[model samples]
Target chain A: MISSKWVVLVIYAMEDGPVRYGEFSRRIEGISKKMLTQTLRQLERDGLIERDIHPTVPPAVEYRLTALGESLLPFMRQLKTWAAANLPLVEAARTRFDAQSLAE
Target chain B: MISSKWVVLVIYAMEDGPVRYGEFSRRIEGISKKMLTQTLRQLERDGLIERDIHPTVPPAVEYRLTALGESLLPFMRQLKTWAAANLPLVEAARTRFDAQSLAE
Candidate 1:
């Protein structure tokens, strides 16, 4: 569930604190309403996030990380760090591999 | 690419030493040949694995982690560790969420 690219961005948005549905839509650019809803539902089902429904005019919903989700944050951050640090090398390798494939 | 489930299993298979294609197909049960080939090619292009071909009557091909890939092993292992440790909680949370949903 967490492996999805949307999952990563959603989790990152929740890093600070609880985020309402509207706020999530705003914070994560390029995510359609359908995708955001689906991601949130999946995270909630996985027990990585809690969905709070406020008893208001329209029942405002907010999402926050559970303890399990919070624990996963550090590891996810590490993966992000690795990606940022090594992307150049990875790109270079891809270029070389493509060139070699063409030669062969 | 790293998020692919096949990628994780493939990396794990190469942890001890270089692994032959047949060995990988055997080690990771249920992974189709097409998937294995695709995963290997992707890893090769990303510079995370080295595909070594040895000259013989029938060319022997092996796959092993590159230095950059080795660096990523620890972080990947940590993710595995976290999953192993917290799976029960996640499962339990899911059950609870499901039960509550049923009532509502």
Candidate 2:
């Protein structure tokens, strides 16, 4: 499986203490609802994320990282930094590619 | 786009100079033919990987990284090292999760 998606999901889910499904979906751009739900379920099943459902007139659910998920923060931070720094180059490559393909 | 897959594709394509489609496919495990073709097309469109077509009795195509693609090697290496080192922990978490779920 592509771990980068999981990494991004983990990072975004833990940005704040705990996040509701809608809040989590809004925070991470470009992720389909299906994918977000699938990822969350996988993470929960893996024990990296915990889902707590409140028992009330209206049920509310929240997700938070477990200790295991917390351990991935440093690595995620490193990846984020690397991606931010190098994104320009990748974008440039894309532009050059477009120009060349147009010429062809 | 998930750059990790691109990173892996670039690394595997450039592992030993230029690689043919079949050779590239064989090297990267778990990638479907459709995904591999899709990835290669995307990479080519982005100019990170160059595809060379040979005119022969049986047409042959090869892929190699451009200079931009080579620059990604360092980042890929870092990710590989991180994954290799941390994979055991992730596996352990999976086992723990499975056991706990079984118990529950």
Candidate 3:
């Protein structure tokens, strides 16, 4: 569970800088609030992300990648690049194959 | 849907030669038979895998990568390398954090 989404989410979220919960949720589309919280907690638990809280009246918390999380950025970037470049070809293949199947 | 799992499955399955459905399932460990069939169909549809049917007394079907699928191998290998190397640290971080949470 954590292995799947956290890798992508953590990399994506931390690419900018220290992000608040709302900011993190907004960046990764389709992740539910509950799942975003879960992923954040898991990442913090796993030492990939650090949660910082300010001592103030309201409350401020921000999340940033630890050394370990930063290490994974290259690999995640590679995956994202591959996905973006090849998606069209893959989609074309699907369309052709589906048409062939329907014909048969 | 297909993009997520199919990438990993096709890469893992095609590391060897043309694989049968059963062999592919066995190698992946946790994927259900239904999901395996679905993934294979998706890959075939996507033009990443080619299904070869042999003319024999019974029936023989094998799957191999098309030119596109072969192109993804290097990127997948990088991801696999990163995961295997970092899993231990990630697991250790989880343990330390969990212990800290319990103490607090």
Backbone clashes for every candidate come to 0, 0, 0
Let me know the TM-score candidate 2 reaches against the reference structure. Answer: 0.69
Ranking by TM-score: 1, 3, 2
lDDT: worst 10-residue window of model 3 chain A: A1-10
Candidate 2 local lDDT, B1-104, one digit each (tens) = 44456447546568568888888667777878887887887777655688899997699998898876676666567657756766676677778778887998
Show where candidate 1 strays beyond 4 Å: A99-104, B98-104
Error of 2 at B75 (Å): 3.6
| Candidate 2 interface RMS | 3.6
Best-first order by DockQ: 1, 3, 2
Q: Which TM-score value belongs to model 1?
A: 0.88
Write model 3 residue lDDT over B25-48, tens digit each, in one string.
678878887777887887788777
Interface RMSD of each: 1.8, 3.6, 3.7
Query: Which residue pairs show collisions in model 2?
Result: none
Native contacts retained per candidate?
0.80, 0.44, 0.62
Highest DockQ, which number?
1
